[model samples]
Target chain A: MPIYGVALLAGCTLVGLFVGDLIGAAMGLEANVGGVGIAMLLLLALTNLPGRDVGPASPSGAGVQFWSLMYIPIIVAMAAKQNVAAAVSGGAMAITAGTLAVLAGFALVPLLSHLARGGGQRGERRDD
Target chain B: MIDVARFADANGLLVAFVFVGLVMLVSAVLARQVGRGRVHASAIAIALGLVLAWAAGVDTGGKNGVADYPLLAGVGVLGGAMFRDFAIVATAFGARVTDLRAAGLAGALSILIGVVLSFAAGAAVAIGFGVTDPAEIATIGAGAATYIVGPVTGASLGVSSSIISLSIAAGLVKAVLVMVATPLIARRIGLDNPASAMVYGGLMGTTSGVTGGLAATDPKLVPYGAMTSTFYTGLGCLMAPSVLYLVVKALV
Candidate 1:
């Protein structure tokens, strides 16, 4: 990744994190607020600014894309490591949350599919 | 003299990386041998991670598992907020504003509806399990949205460590289920075309699961499905700590 793009991202992230900390402090939170989320929103807005015409295929754009693709899996791995550690040792509630979440997701599939089918048909009707 | 043991201790992250890489390699081999690609490498990796975490916890009696060891201290920094937050912020690149227009209203609505329903279902489960804390409930609910959402919600809400872990476990389970089930039920669920895959992804919301499942079902559908699933994480991240948490708080 180009240093500039990475640096730019880092700068944005720090500012966002600082602001998030401020927000968290204001809310009486003992931790950072939505720093990462705010940084993402700011990055997205800045990068995709209307009429800017920064080609998505450009090197800088590609650099951003490259890091972005790596984001979820990497973070998930790191976070999953911590979460796994916690769940394995903690009370039954942790396990319960995980189990129920999966069950809930499975249960929602049919209902969601049904809704999707109806919506798809409606769209088809509109197009026709 | 550069002592080898001291170097090893200093380069803890390197050790952690090696450890994780070995797990991935083993998981991949296991998936190939046992699951025959039916089970995703990621699912196996997560299972291995949990096992390792449990073992490390037992051995060290510490909160951070292997990171408690002098040689494995890098795991803590490697998995800390600096890296975690950076990875999260970088996800913004995946969201192309223009591509979203293709999904349009139906797709958009499905994403929102999917998020809400998942959150509600997860929250309901938390309540049933006697978890009355709004933060805990919301974190679990967000995990139902996606594993990524779970930690973000938990961290934002400042819930306990265990609750956050549960959220991740929930997301992982969902991912595994989505990976294994999507191909089997693809035709039955009308997951045949790009549009339908997009809808399915929106409704499911786990990027790894949606993408892996679509890859198994039909390689061509992976991109379409992944697109919406990416949006699902962003949406979940936004809603879980804010809207969904608020709703759960109000109810409880």
Candidate 2:
């Protein structure tokens, strides 16, 4: 968790990413595999912390701030490097698709899931 | 034409998501022990998450214009200091919400829902723009994994850490136009659990993703488990590819 180590990890992640990109050119699977590896690494970073609270949940607002602040430079750098206006042109439509899907999930999925359990509930009643 | 480490950067949101989750989860225990004082674990989690982000450079570079390094892994261990019984009233009874199993189930369900949607949004951008950059792929992959990692890691490492950046600006833009905004889709809908709310992910994907890390360690929220597993993931998967397509389209 030291700064030096964090630097080292970030560097390694970039190196790994670069290597994977290059390798992916020859064989399409490299990026896919490496990407998954990266995903796993991210998952491993925080969620793996040991301890479980099966209680009412709460999260710190400050934690979200520091993390976002730290990472903003990276995003801005990416945007600034590009034709920012161009890249953002269709960003709205894309987000729209996702928004729709989520809404559908809440509206339709919840109802369907409940209906699926209708028989399950009846069976439970019989057992009771 | 040159792609940055976009995937790696995006995937990095996992750390932030999990770390928030760990802090909240720990506080949940404390909430029980201290008799319900700091139950705003989300508030505490946001604070701690921001600190972790700063420590890791998960967000903007410091005034020095360099990335920050991530730490706070050890800080997560303090979660154990809190050990107390928690009480959860069923948000809704019967089949709709799976019987409340663990606080984590709620987080996980929400996290998974958030991830799947993010993936879709990314895919849509990709397809809409025809982007096949390694950076974009990496970004989408990271998005997919961010939500589910906390449960995976919490088994060993302890509390979640920090994963962040990217979505804040986008969220800000959306916040400005909530009525016409994509994230506002949640607002259009009626009452429900706000944890898995898409707007939360949009405005604060990093925070929600990091907090969502609780899915792994805590008992699956059996009551809402149906929504968590089937709905969140089901919809999440469906949405990711489309979003990816959109990302590609935008880039192209």
Candidate 3:
């Protein structure tokens, strides 16, 4: 994964953003519809293309891996908090939704786990 | 010493990156020193960010908090879709089709069930709060599915910013619960195997929550839970702004 490979990813991400913006416009929506999803699809396709493979354990592979891994934990963790804080002040509705959703999720678990069980000890344990 | 503030304003994004990096670093150190790894750094960082954003909001008298400052305007771009979406897309590289097959029908079922149930729960809450607009209801509902889903759905539907924010809040609440509760109740739920972990992840849908919770319970199960949770976010994104919104619109 040389600098060029990283550059290619940036290029693909921009292209994907453009395409997503276009889709959002076409649908008359304000959001980019699956821009990252489209970008990932493009990257996957581009990476596997002819002559694209530098070799086994290539630097490009490592580069893409590095960026991808970095993107997830840090960026997602940060943005989600920002978004939530901004919205929590919106009103009581959101607070209600947040609190209820958690409670509902908790209530759903036992029922879901039971339904998920196929049989045997796992299934039997639930009854007790 | 030409205006230091102006330089920060010009390089706001870079400055923001540095500040964010510092926050993450500090959170990690604190978590290590005091939390003994029980409190994840990511959680601590989020709390710190919230406090900073609140301080910035009060100082600047603006809506965007830290982003209201010219020197910190880059926070928006740093946390914007460009990077966020890149991260989401990047997750695909780690996944393999063969590995996904292990979950089979159970995993697949969990994703659908998780999305619908979460959506319904959120939507019900919104309606109880007297929300009439179908788009608003759906956006909040989608947020219940995942914070990522809420914004995507809200943006796609052109809902109000407040609604999108609420969605994110709902998702975050669910995430925190998942993180704290998963470990405490793993045994009672029989969440011991890879297949069960995948199902649990799907049912939860928040990747951070699923991964963190699973990590607290059994680190080996983290990958499996995260894989399905990732899929759950993608699925929620697809359904929330479209099929789910349409259904809600028709009903209301």
Candidate 4:
């Protein structure tokens, strides 16, 4: 069931958060560092175990799959949690930074695609 | 009659879930009927959420937006850091190793390049805006990587809440723009194939935006794009608050 997935995710999250805190402490920082990222790595590793039937097709995997796609709601919730008026009134910097960053990212897409084309073509041939 | 207000207060999280569901339902309809599928429903939902939060802030004169209302008090917890992190981590479950292999080295490089370039652009803008603190700058730059990364980095760095909010706003803008722009420029960018799609996903780094944009461009490419994009967020989360923060500190 999806609950099992949630259980697995919860375990990963706790372990991840603990490790993140340890890392932060080691770095002389006061916060949990990369806890969510660590949890994701754990989940990815667990779900992709070799010769395991725990892939998305399995029951627990179904739970994992369901929550994985449910990120939209979570994202929306996160957005809603923000104080937009405060952020906007604070300065033009946020918008400016965001827009420029996106533009920069967009500009690089073509270059990366071109660079990847040769390698991607070889991979495609091997797969075929 | 039932004491509805008290009941809502008691079930705030449930109410918040129901309320967000309604908003999403409406957003999906709007995306189809008004946006004509060019825009992703999640983008519209985010926009709507921001507007509602703004309205709630103005109406109640409170900091937590709609959560200030007793009936929606659960929004505070529902949208809290705990659930946010849980959701983000769970997204990794959808990624497949085979998909990553198909995209090759370019796919991996694109993610690193995308994260660094986006972070640098954001940090530069923050510096231009006269932000002197490295932590704040790194947090904002991480937000440029993705919304999830921004807050995670901010919380890790112990930056102010307002700064974290700004970071999220920055990421949101990127996601919306990416969703709207992908189809319009797909052909010109040669995003017709799965390999290119994966690279595009790595570059964009917003799973929802990449998936939505690719779905509009070609449904067959969504899986490929989403896989790398998922990795993008993970990489951003891992790097932003640690290595990137130190780098910003050194420079500043």
Question: TM-score of B chain for each model?
Answer: 0.94, 0.31, 0.92, 0.94
In order of TM-score, best first, we have 4, 1, 3, 2
Backbone clash count, each prediction separately: 0, 118, 2, 0
The residue-by-residue lDDT of candidate 2 on A1-128, one tens digit each, is 23432333344345434543454454433221232233223323332235621221213212222332333222222212222222234445434433443343344333232223343554443211
lDDT of 4 at A65: 76
Candidates ranked by lDDT, best first?
4, 1, 3, 2
Across B29-52, the per-residue lDDT of candidate 2 in tens digits comes to 654565243223333333333334
Query: lDDT: which is higher, 2 or 3?
Result: 3
The residue pairs that clash in candidate 4, if any, are none
Instruction: Please provide, for model 1 over A24-122, each residue's C-alpha lDDT reduced to its tens digit, 9 standing for 90 to 100.
Output: 788665656666667877777777779764344766666666666655445434643563555654345544554554454445554555454565554
What would the DockQ be for model 4?
A: 0.63
lDDT per residue as tens, model 3, B50-167: 5676666556656665666676777777766566666666665555444566667777788888888889889998888888999899998998898778877776787765566677
* Fnat (0 to 1) per candidate: 0.37, 0.01, 0.34, 0.72
B1-252: candidate 1 lDDT, tens digit per residue: 877657878787787677666777888899999999998887777766666666776677776655666666666676666777776777766777787887776578768877887888788878987888888999888887887788888888888766776777778778888898888877766678776777788888888888889899999999877877777877787677776777898899
Name the regions of candidate 2 deviating beyond 4 angstroms. Answer: A11-68, A85-128, B1-252
Interface RMSD of 1: 3.2
Candidate 3's displacement at residue B11, Å, is 2.4
TM agreement with the true structure for every prediction = 0.86, 0.35, 0.84, 0.93
Which tens-of-lDDT digit does each residue in A25-95 have in candidate 3? 78776666666556765776677667667332588666667666665344533442253345555557766
Any idea what lDDT model 1 has? Answer: 0.72
Error of 2 at A64 (Å): 13
> Per-residue lDDT tens digits of candidate 4, residues B138-225?
9999988887789889888888767888888788888877888888888877788877888889988988788988887899999989
lDDT of 4 by residue, A25-119 (tens): 99998878788889988988887778976777888888777777767787777667667666667557877877887788777776777777784
